[model samples]
Target: MKPHLTLPIAIATALALAACSAAEPPAPAEPPVATETPATPMPADPMPATPANPSVGGAAMDAGKDIVTNASAAPNLSTLVAAVKAADLVATLQGAGPFTVFAPTDDAFAKLPAGTVDGLLKPEMKADLAGLLTYHVVAGNVDAAALTQQIEVGGGSATLTTVQGAILTAMSDGAGGITLTDGKGGTAKVTTADVRQSNGVVHVIDSVLMPK
Candidate 1:
């Protein structure tokens, strides 16, 4: 009797499978996962660059000090220091000038005819020495960049008015340096430049600048 009921039993089993599948609802399609794309990581900011400070007279210059003080600290400028003091121009140079000084080294002073510096340092020659010293100083802060710009604008030579009412000429040395010409037509090369001071800038010259 069991063998005779095989067909009806197979049909009943198939119907039961279909009923179970329909009742389960096919697992609801797994509910699409809301995947959010991760945001790109941002880069960190770069560090600021440091400024360059140049040395003069075998020592670094202090921008916190005035011209007279800074120059007095330089060993190579001893003659210049003495001359400044002898001329009684220390107070003037130390004041709020913003003057550009073409400072000559001791070697530069030596280049003059024998006893020239000694003669200038005499009490009776104080006025003359002051005039000569002032000739090396130009009013206002004239950095190398300013001199370069002026030279470019002035057709390769820039004329600067000095504190002594004399004209000084600045020109490029064709070797990435600067040269200055005084009223006496003497030219001096800037051995060191852009020496910052509280009141102005100092450009160390290899030779003393003489004015007519």
Candidate 2:
């Protein structure tokens, strides 16, 4: 009876050991294999466009201000500024519209028939003065590239309609210089090109544009 009891006890112990082995916690799943994902590459920087000609009239053109405000900075444009004020065009130019102005220097105004500017400043001649001023402006901002492309498209000449409803012609005046022909067949050579303003662009012209 004692030997039979010993054998049964040993079998029970062996069964308990098998159950404990089966219940082990799966060795923690091998810690998920530690996979390392490669990092994404960063994009390259963009190349900046070439800058246009330097600002005109010994001052850098301010892109943050409107055409009128920027034009006021040019020492050579004082006469043009006075004419603009007298003609009441400051508000119009300061508005949201993007107007292209062929700005004339003081020397350009001097080229006008003597007393022409004085006469235009008169109260009764305001309309005429405004017309003349507007003639120098186009409805949209016309940059140097656009002007040159238009000239090429028009077989070496481009006709731009001014804000005053007059036609002005643009043509290459030899060696990459541009000349604008007004309604009266007078020409204004662009001494400086691409004077960027906030609301528009300005090309400093050697002569003021006149409308018929």
Candidate 3:
């Protein structure tokens, strides 16, 4: 395999070139603006705090039940339990978000070789930690049924607008499951679904979703 193949997919997703300029060969012209045309469904732009839920919860829900407590109750998520709290996202998790969180269990995070998690938790690394945490949350109330159905139809993909204001592309696994392609194109599989809460739903994944 090529050495570039080893680079994280998140990086690639983040840096994808929007376009490349070509040499100028003609005079610049103003683009056309259409006059009164029927509007059509514009696929979707990730989904930034939809109309149904326009609230932001940066810190008001710390005392409420959150991903940490929920993941903790499940014996298999002990590690994920630690990471969520460490990232200072427990409160955000409990906020009245209607957030669609793609949660990874403890064992899923263990897939990383070593030292990565430790380095990310350093005090100076708060920004990086926050980005990683928010990448797991889609800004609206997206249920599994909605996701799978989106794929089954020819949608082929749906973009999720992360709390960090980043986009994560999700595609179907073709086996009644969904796979999330991180900003860098890294994929995380949904292992469990519909872990409901007052604010939103949680879907357990077998791998951590990283941003590029």
Q: Model 2, 1-212: lDDT tens per residue?
A: 57879988999999999999998877655556687899998988889885753576787778778989888888999999998999999999998879899999999999989998899888888889999999999988889999999999999999999889889999998799899998888999999988887788888999988888
All models, RMSD in angstroms: 3.8, 6.5, 35.8
lDDT of 3 at 209: 85
Residue 97 in model 2: shift from native, Å?
A: 1.0
Question: Local error of candidate 3 at 196, Å?
Answer: 1.1
- TM-scores, all models, native as reference: 0.82, 0.79, 0.65
Return the TM-score for candidate 2, rounded to 2 decimals: 0.79
The whole-model lDDT of each prediction reads: 0.91, 0.89, 0.72
Q: Mark the regions of model 2 whose C-alpha exceeds 4 Å error after superposition.
A: 1-40, 47-53
**Candidate with the greatest TM-score versus the true structure:** 1
Which number leads on lDDT? 1
Candidate 1: how many backbone clashes? Answer: 0
lDDT for model 2, please. 0.89
Which of candidates 1 and 2 reaches a greater TM-score? 1
Clashing pairs in 1: none
